[model samples]
Target chain A: MPQLSTFYHTLLRGRAGLLTGAALLLGSLLSGCDLIEFSPNETRTPEAYSDLTRKNLERLRQQPNPSGGDTVRFVFVGDSQRFYEEAEAFTQSVNQQRNVAFVAISGDISDFGLIREMRWVHDRLKKLNVPYLTVIGNHDLVANGREAYQKVYGPLNYSFEYGHTRFVLVDTNGREYGFNGRVPDVPWVQQALASPGPGISRQVVMSHVPPHDLDFDPQLVSPYVQALSTAPRVAFELNGHKHDFSIGQPYENGLTFINSYSFEKRQYVVLTLWGEKEFKLDTVQY
Target chain B: MRRALLLPLLLLASLLPAAAQSAASAATPDTLSLALAAAPAAEPEPAEPAAAVAPTGLTAQPWYRPHHLILQTAAGQGLITAGVGYTTLRGRVDIDVLAGYVPSKYSITPMGIFTAKAAYSPWTLPVAQGRWQLRPFSVGGFVSHTASSGLNNSRDGKYEKGYYWWSSRTRVGGFVGGKVSRVIGRNRYGHPRTLGAYYELGTNDLYLSSIFTNLGGLGVHEILTLGFGVKFDL
Candidate 1:
């Protein structure tokens, strides 16, 4: 609501006018510049995490666990891209492969996760043959986006398992306004990785802001990395938002953090976990 | 041109004999006796003059106003337009098609549009003569379908997508205006071209139903356009 009253209406006023002299002057100067997306080694706020996580965790305990059998391969995608277009393409591509049970989006399902974006994304995601879960990103907090996200995508921090693997989606995008020295809350994340349901052969953590990026706090990275590394089943930590592809070294706890590239122009990552420990990472382009 | 002049000249000459006959009858008793005897026969002679000047009002005859131009600004866009038009064979219905470019400040470069409109007024307001100048005004409704603009690659260094109704969209609205013409300088055709300024106000986009919500950096809005253009009757 603050952004609606503040920036959105102001933007509308800025857009109106018979002669848009001011907008024309301002828009021209800003269009050609390539602004920085993230700074170097920035840290998140050190403030205590909100009670919403605990409330979410308590609710998560009530949900039934997924039943597993043979190999279940569901595609992992990132970025909402152009909402419906991205959703349609992802659905079509996944359907072509068939047998996909679910989808996990890294983050940024909407540029500004307002109610409309929430509804739009929700409608598009519904087109998928399987239930899809989304992680929260910075851009998703435009208006009452937090409430909308919770209402549409369920709890921000929740875990669900399918067959032999477990998926933990967290809201690494901190408070809507500014960041402090903390992002991946160690206690909440530690609990999320602890898997309450049936034990799986692999564990994968999904978030929007990658710890490798400087925009994420340096303090939060160590604890997050430590948590993921400690899990032997945790073979991949898939994320997006750098708009580029990156693969980090095996952490101290021996975990691979793969930052997925932007989903623009049909880009996605396909991870094939063979048997129990062996795996292959393939970048699929359509 | 010389052949065109012969018809009206012949018509004027034909009226001379009738006028002379009526004059002779009015002056003599013998002529009056003959006039009374020939009254029914003489009736057709006077009706020819009325037919010669049949166009009685300003709006009665059609004028093919083939040139017009306009400059419009609204909703963060600027437009320049010009076009040509003509009247129907019956000399009452009028139609014109115009095209223009719309440049916006959102780095969405200029767009082009083509619109056609038609209207008719049964009678033109009487023109004031002498010190009593006649200020006539007429109101009629018109609808236009504007074409999407072509991409402009110069301003933003990118091709602007056309303003298809599916994309940027087009609007449908009604238009009304008044013409305050006190006849200006004669055009090359020798017809009095009226000069007046007209204003039109209208609403568009009745099909789209939008919900207004208060979101961070998001809000719903309606776009309204008000513009001034030259007005004349054809």
Candidate 2:
């Protein structure tokens, strides 16, 4: 034991040994606790990186709405998967915008549903001037992604209210579940959309796969869409996974669905909503 | 799902006793031959003189026997990993099989990762008068399969073929590392047994793909994973 201690001390005493020790220390610091990843799909995350949805919501609650009117304005984007350069630029662009309350990402934050991928996206998104939130996507459910998403963000389906709006974020990637009839949790969405607290003027639903897409469960489509259309003060449903932007009333009931631009598109929509379903869409290219 | 989880546990359970038995019966002269090749005059005096009596010629052990045992953590393998390895080519190459575990807290369910790895070290420098050894550089590759009861299969029958080209359960990765070892004692074959500590910097296939596709977007450091371990020569 004495020899071992002396050996270590001798090794650390030399210039080369000092350099090696310094390099190791620097590497550990640079990688943070994330350097020792048990698995790429492992759900463990540092406190700062975990429960982001809740943290972002808390941050949003603390910051007063920049638009002082009865209006809510948020930058909408999605599919930031592996788009690190674009995310940095997106953050810079969003920071420059005035009166933006927050950023809403529809889904698909990580291409591989890996913790590091989510952390990478967060590393950039955390730089934005305003708080940002995310919904779980099909990619985020890959392998151990469900747990990873729950650990890194908060939940697969969650709702938050800010600036007179109730945002219902749900998981709609049915194919990932083998088209199991339980996905999108129609009952839960209905429950969330059905309740609007005081000062809540409109409801905005967000998810990854829209009902029309093949990835969505065909069996639950009618029930899921019906839940949204019948909900009172519903503005429009927001979706990603298509990687492009589209807005239409595909159903006979005239329920509007607004698709968002993926991060790689170098564009995002700024949605300004007020007075019930009245809203304006402005596209900003970074 | 239970069967998938059980397989790695069974494999791990089966390997330990076999490694212990091999270590017990490892009286063959081949161990000395490799030790001599590694360190010609580095032999430490034996604590048990009865175990040091050796035949002159190199007699090979059973092919299935491993020369060393390994325990490691991280590097996207598992929280704790244990394995056995065979060193060959005068200690320049090592081939190993390992089983690793991550608890339910870190995943949807407790996960079992089974891995096969091969490493090559081009240089082994004697340090501190051969009482310690330094392998300055090692390049290696590994393939691992993860089995968890609650893991959602990426390639399940739910999607059309090629929907997701990569398999979430399996990973192929490469690493570069260095190791430092100290001679511990003499084995039955009169070889200077060593205990070594190592560190590996690695990246998996999905990480490689992420960085390859986003050269300007993701930095090399972001895709890297680090693992640390200790190896004991039997």
Model 1 DockQ (Cα-based):
0.01
TM-score for chain B of each model, two decimals: 0.45, 0.80
TM-score of 1: 0.43
Q: Score the docking of each candidate (DockQ).
A: 0.01, 0.37
- Could you say which candidate leads in TM-score? 2
Query: Which digits, one per residue and each the tens of the lDDT, describe model 2 over residues A1-286?
Result: 6975576576565423433344344445544566788888798888888999889999999999888777999999999987889999999999999999999999999998888899999999999999999999999988888888888898899998899899999999999999889998999999999868778999999999999999999999999999999999899999999999999999999889999999999999999999999999999999
Of candidate 1 chain A, the 10-residue stretch with the lowest lDDT total is A36-45
* Quality of model 2 by C-alpha lDDT: 0.84
Q: Kindly list the per-residue Cα lDDT of model 2 for residues B101-151, writing each as its tens digit.
A: 999888988888888899999998988876778999999999999988788
Per-residue error at A106 for model 1, in Å? 0.5
List, residue by residue over A1-286, the lDDT tens digit for candidate 1. Answer: 5853455454334212111233333334433221110000001111121232343334444533322353555566777734455555666676665444555678776554433455445545556555566788765543334544554455777776655667788777643323454566768778877754445777778898877765466667787787777755676788877766778774555567777666564766666653455566666666
Model 2 clash tally?
0
Chain A TM-score for each candidate, in the given order?
Answer: 0.69, 0.89
TM-score of 2: 0.86
Instruction: Give the poorly placed runs of model 1, Cα more than 4 Å off.
Output: A1-70, A175-177, A195-198, A250-253, B1-234
